[model samples]
Target: MKRFIAVLVFAVVAFSCSKEKGNMVVKGQIKGLKKGTLYLQKMNDTLLVSVDSVKLFGDDKFLLSDNVESPVMYYLTFDGNTQEKKIMFFGEPGEITINDNVEEFGWKPGISGSKNQEVMDKFNEINQQFKLKRLDFIAKDMEARAKKDTAAMDSLEKEYKKMVRRRFLFTTNFAVANPDTEAAPYIALSELFDANLYLLDTINNSLTSRVKSSDYGMRLQKFIDDVKAQEKK
Candidate 1:
């Protein structure tokens, strides 16, 4: 009876460890998050459902996990509906580490351990430049409108359209270059959804079969098909 009890205890301990870690292990620290509830979330048919949560009374470190069916985006946020104060990262079936300060939680987080997130980080770095230029153009346009300068307003509008086209082309090329990663489809679906069909098709055709079958990949394919069907009508 003693030997049987020892075996049962070991089994129970293993089961508990597996249950806590799950498939995707999300463990990290928010430097100033002293006492608050953190929730790990993902989209399930448009709903942001929490997979796991932890309440930290003293320590800043936390652990949350979920069984990822396939690699997708995830949100790490605090309790209640504070959507703005959260970190969004690409979640996969491995351990991911996220460390940031509570002051600038999502502004510039240091996320590692996922190849997809690395790709996203690189893309975002370049995209930020385009976003800044867009802001400058918006401010100039507003100034022109206030002064009733028709010629300046026309020039600004034309320049803005050119910048938009450049961004679209750049995004399409980036997606094509990273064809094997699931991020490619996601980039096309998110960044170039409203772009010309030709550009969207180019990115879609360049995706690898494995990535083409991913959640975002399948969604991109469906989105393209739906658009084609609409045009046919």
Candidate 2:
């Protein structure tokens, strides 16, 4: 009786441990994906490593589970014969759901679960406007070059610079307004890095203390220091 009770207690403890292991759950369905593999990848130091994977055969559904220490960027990569597609998302320690059609894989899919992801989606929506403007500039530049119109080419170059400055200002504003989020520092470094050093310093100084101590925040500070050192030389 004593041995049996001990075995039962051990079983209960083992089940509890298993339940507490996984902190993040990712479940999704890919329409028209008959047979393929799905990889859930995250950056481990400098390398993008696959933390979880699922092999699907004649099924369009998959589930992946892992533990995340904080809000971080993650990738959902589809391995197929003809082409490979990857979707990036800011993942947190919770359940996230994604739904996408394999036929239209390159387009943004529906993702839900993390607040950081929602912030990223909002940023992308605004960033798309700038992207369209850049495309228009590219088209006009090409046309001017094809016609050998030096005056038009010069005008277009000025307009292109104005557009770049406008985009940089918008990014800086967004970072300043959303200082508590990880996306703020990320955009300051990734999107507005080429802007004026004073503008970068402004964004960095505006971040909250908690955000300033974050991983991306520290990186951004270091980047600014490096750029200043270069300028001094």
**Candidate 2 TM-score, C-alpha based:** 0.85
Error of 2 at 175 (Å): 1.4
Q: Give per-residue CA lDDT, model 2, range 176-202, as digits (tens).
A: 888888778888887987789988999
Give the Å shift of residue 159 in candidate 1.
Answer: 0.7
Compare the candidates by TM-score and give the number of the best one: 1
- Distance from true position, residue 139, model 1, in Å? 0.5
Structure candidate 1, residue pairs in collision? none
List TM-scores for all candidates, in order. Answer: 0.91, 0.85
Q: Summarize candidate 1's per-residue lDDT along 92-144 as a digit string, tens digits.
A: 98899999888888889999988889999989999999999999999999999
